[model samples]
Target: MKATVSWQQALTFSGKTESGFSQTLDGNGETLSPMETVLLAVGACSSIDVVDILKKRRLTIHDCQCELEADRAEEPPRVFTKIHAHYIVSGDNLKEKDVDRAVSLSAEKYCSVMLMLKGNVVITTSYTIVD
Candidate 1:
């Protein structure tokens, strides 16, 4: 739950999580920006929940990928106003209802990052299952 960032010169930084994972972030477009990281966090968080939920239901999930599209406000402090999460799921005997329910549960209950941004961000989710 905790992370640290060190300056890497010229608006760039190296961030390390408590789990020892590290990433390079830069504001000059050389790497992932802070805002882009946030978007990624949201996508990753929800994807984890979706995959886990499906597995727990005894569904054989071969692969899961999420494509996130976001829109930010035009003015300063440009924060995300809308986010669309499109999940492409590949598995055996994956039911549409199950996928829909999994996504709904993640958005409404499981995903912490999505819950945190509930009010400020409009989040929408959809999924396509590949047999």
Candidate 2:
């Protein structure tokens, strides 16, 4: 839960977690900006939930991918105003209801990252199941 951010260079920083993981981020366009990283995290977090839920259902999953689209306010701070997550799940004998439930559970209950932004940001989700 603990982390630190150290300045590396002009608009660049190194972020390290207490668990010994680290990441480099830059405010400039040279790399993934802090905001961009957050956007990515949202998709990753939700995707994890979807994968876990589907696995628990014993569906023979082949792959799962989450595609995210976001909108930001034009004003200063430029925080995310809206986000949409599209999940592409491939498996045998996958039911539409199961996929829908997994996506819904992730967005509505799981996925702490999405839940944290639930009120301030408009979060939406969709999914496609493929064989």
Candidate 3:
């Protein structure tokens, strides 16, 4: 519930929770940025539900990866304009209907981050089923 960010260097930091788990955050232009990390939080938050919903339906999951893209506003203070998450799911005998339903349920009903991003950012998704 509580956390802190300690400075590491220019555009880099380490954020740690009260429980002590920590992650290195950096504007390295390759992996982590502040805005990119926000999108990651949103993606990871929803991905949990997506996988859980699919698993409860008895779907076999080989792999699941979410690719998040965002359009940021051009202004003195930038903000997100739109966001999209493409879920690439690899599995044997996966059903498109199930994947669609799971995604829909997460965005519309289950995922809180998705709800928060509504209006400010247009959120959308597409799925690829890999056999």
Candidate 4:
């Protein structure tokens, strides 16, 4: 879990992970802001867990999308106050109980990013399965 960031120019940066993945981050609104990247990480982390869990259950999954919403404190170091991840999962024979279990397992046990923020940030999750 190692990464680095290089200054590209005024308030912009090019970030890369040791694994060879890279993304552009900017404070001048040229790309995703640092805070926005955090939210994206939370969503991406949980969604991957959900999809993997569902697949391991032998469910036929077609698509998975995580929509995130957040609130930030209106003060210096304005950190996240609350966050929500709404998962839209499409598949065949996807039951509510299964989806619920997957979401719960990710929030409570699997998603590292979400779990790390549990104490400092209020996190909530919901899911919708379309067949």
lDDT of 3: 0.87
lDDT of each: 0.96, 0.93, 0.87, 0.96
Q: Where is the poorest 10-residue window by lDDT in model 4?
A: 122-131
- Measured against the true structure, the TM-scores of the candidates, in listed sequence, are 0.97, 0.98, 0.87, 0.97
**lDDT at 130, model 1:** 97
Residue by residue across 1-131, what tens digits does model 2's lDDT show?
79999999999999999999999999888888998888999999999999899999988889999999999999988999999999999999999999999999999999999999989999999988889
Q: Which 10-residue window in model 3 sums to the lowest lDDT? A: 27-36
Give the per-residue lDDT of model 3 (tens digit) for 1-131: 89999988878888999999988888776447778878998789888888999999888898889999999999946889888999888877988999999888988899898898788888998888888
| Model 1 residue-pair collision total | 0
Note the clash tally of each candidate.
0, 0, 0, 0
Q: Rank the candidates by lDDT, best first.
A: 4, 1, 2, 3
Error of 4 at 93 (Å): 1.0
Candidate 1 lDDT, 81-101, residue by residue in tens: 999999999999999999999
Q: Kindly provide the TM-score of model 1 when superposed on the true structure, using C-alpha atoms.
A: 0.97
